[model samples]
Target: MVSSDHIGPNETGRIRATVKTDGKKGRILKTVQVETNDPVRPLVVLKLRANVIDAFHEKPLQPDAIFRSPCRKCHLDRGRDQMGAALFRADCIMCHMRGKSAPSISSLKKLSRERLKEAIEEGVPDSMMPGFSWRVGGPLTEAQIRSLLKYIKGR
Candidate 1:
């Protein structure tokens, strides 16, 4: 849904927003999409249930889709444009801090799942690494973090 302003014909970025349906019972869902302009990004026409009732339906385009969420850094971007890559990129702190000797997680060059998980839980001290398990203001939820790990593992 990244619209014309944030996403031109060729800007690589991310889309994250929520969709919800209101009724006797409703649910809110968060969605994320990453894309490079190689092929015009496909419009995602998500058909969703508007309420807890299976019969209810609602389809809302993500705000980030309407307004592209530009990634802060593009130099480090490899093919990790996917959400899995974004999760792995979280480890860039430790990878680049160690410099040549440290593994380059920023490159999206796959890493052992366990290693990446460890990096998330117990960051490399004295380096840019920071533990998400108890970060005072970091955004990832435990479930979200696990989902990202599982997704990367599958990849």
Candidate 2:
């Protein structure tokens, strides 16, 4: 998206762009090309770079904040009545997918079933990974946790 299609002589224009940081992290780079009438520089390329932080990157002062308000919309609601890959896509992928702060799906596949189950139920110590089991104040139920475990291990 651009601010304007044309710029008058001796005038300046703006180029605007938006990147969806959801399910992504680390350094991100993108490029945009603009065509101009200037003979000396008919085309200009703009480089956009950003460092995405995890949605839960904030201090542990409010670990359960994700289960409330605006965060709940994406973190909780999306996983309602969902199971297996669908559930992971809705709830887990945002942070656990590639390039994000948490472990990627491929990496998770390497863990034993018991380890994965414990992580999901009890969360990891001193890490951003939060417990998704109801006993730990998370939104997932026993059945859901089982489903997630099965899905993750199968992958």
Candidate 3:
């Protein structure tokens, strides 16, 4: 796919590249990246049309990809539900827990809801437990913090 900026359709001063993957038949379908220059009004159109860094080029994620967050391994990926799931899988709690692993969603099932929320606030320091960045810290949003809690609890 291509992103057209103020470069006015097919123009010059742009960058272009092609990506392809091997197919079972030995042939492959390639993804293309063609950028036209229009410094006058370029305005970051690379991502507006296609993210050049994406290897799959809009292809459905592989199973492993589904297990992690696409945006940031350190931050939320999609909706709260998906983001939380990614956090849980990534063992985000261990960021400060040191040698301990993040509580499994199954194990969290045994904890009381009140306790869970409390733990979220007071992270298991030395482990990967990242206190809800939005709660008492800076940066992370409320939704992300909430998602981390929800993900920890396997909700």
Q: Largest TM-score belongs to which candidate?
A: 2
- CA RMSD per model (angstroms): 18.9, 5.0, 13.7
Q: List where candidate 3 sits over 4 angstroms from the true fold.
A: 1-82, 91-102, 125-130, 152-155
Give the clash count for each candidate. Answer: 3, 0, 12
lDDT of 3 by residue, 56-96 (tens): 32564332232244424333332335456664555344222
Which tens-of-lDDT digit does each residue in 29-128 have in candidate 1?
A: 4445444443666544343334366332144332112112232232123223334546555434323434544554433237777787776565556554
TM-score of 3: 0.34
lDDT of 1: 0.46
Write the number of the candidate with greater TM-score, choosing between 1 and 3: 3
Candidate 1 Cα outliers beyond 4 Å, as residue runs: 1-102, 106-112, 135-137
Which is superior by TM-score, 2 or 3? Answer: 2
Considering TM-score, which of the candidate structures 1 and 2 is the better prediction for this target?
2
* TM-scores of the models, in the order given: 0.31, 0.63, 0.34
